[model samples]
Target: MKTFCGILWEGVRKELQMSFSAFFRLLLGALKSFLNAETLQCQVFTSDEENGQLESRFISLVSNDDHKFTCNKKILSSKSDVFKTLFAGSENDQCVRFQEIEKNLIKIDDVDGETLREILRYVYFDVVDQNIMDPNPNLPFKCLLAAEKYMLDQKFKDSCQDFLVLSVDDENAFDYFRLAENLNAEQLKLSVGDYISQYLTHKRDVLP
Candidate 1:
């Protein structure tokens, strides 16, 4: 009788183990099916029209000529002190009353379309080719104005200064010096003076 009772208990425990094993298998199968369904339901938004959906999170900048640009608020605020301060009061902010204010956009009256485009691209990706300084001679000045307007980082301002210095010639050297003085760019002012002095020395040496 003891042997039979022991055998019965063993059968009960085996059944319980098998039941739990089946239950867990079913649960895992259901979870995988749900995940597959969710994956199938998700859609990719890679096109230009799909970018408009980000308006709720992005800041809308409207140019004077009615050109519109959208930028990531977090990126701008992180990179620019001007944007950081503007967005700081957002919690109790009366100026930006609408949480999703596509209608109430930022007005960019001073910066031209092309300069603003380059600035926005730089803000997004932190890249601008130095080669552009030669073909577009006035680009540095435009960039300076945009940088000052945005109150951007020292790196960006310095990059613009470096470009101006590299592109400066006797014809544009005095103009750059004046621009440096106006913008308080000491690096560029010194660069201008050095470039002119070097040019004068070169001319004197080359004289027959």
Candidate 2:
């Protein structure tokens, strides 16, 4: 009877030891998973903060750079011609209309940096080629077409967004305009137009 009791006590001790080992292993695994999750979240947040800072710098460049240029050729090459034709360059003239339009465009904030560069490039080339403003009424549509071609020639996201901002208003704008234009499509072009229109018109739920 004494031998049986001793053997029973030994078996109980071994079982307790195994149970404790298993519990400890599970606890360690849970701790590891928690640490890994926390680390991943921290990395993502850091990346997002960095991106926000970069975007702020880009916006400052556009707003403070005094971009004395426009997307129209006539405006760049013959600022006088545009002024004369549109406003007669008179003190009490239509030049104010252009100025107002410019002021509004300038007030636009949050345009992507790459998009601004692409738009600047397009405007620069248009000035060189003397094709900024089309003689025809369909010129805005043509601008969209030109933007598509430009985006295709150069693979950049910034240019595409600039083009979209400038041309999305026209009724003739294409459905897959970004794809056709060779522009970078970070998001759907239609969605972009919807957002812009909403801001401009103060109408929400108007996105297609």
Task: Specify the highest-TM-score model's number.
Answer: 1
Q: Candidate 1 on 78-147: residue-level lDDT in tens? A: 7777677776754534334223335537777776676777777678678776665666878877988778
- TM match of model 1 to true structure: 0.62
Report, for every candidate in turn, its global Cα lDDT versus the true structure.
Answer: 0.73, 0.42
Model 1: per-residue Cα lDDT at residue 92: 35
Residues 148-178, model 2: lDDT tens digits? 4332223223333454445454453444444
lDDT, model 2:
0.42
Predict model 1's lDDT versus the native.
0.73
Name the lDDT value of residue 62 in candidate 1: 69
Residue 147 lDDT, candidate 2, scale 0-100: 42
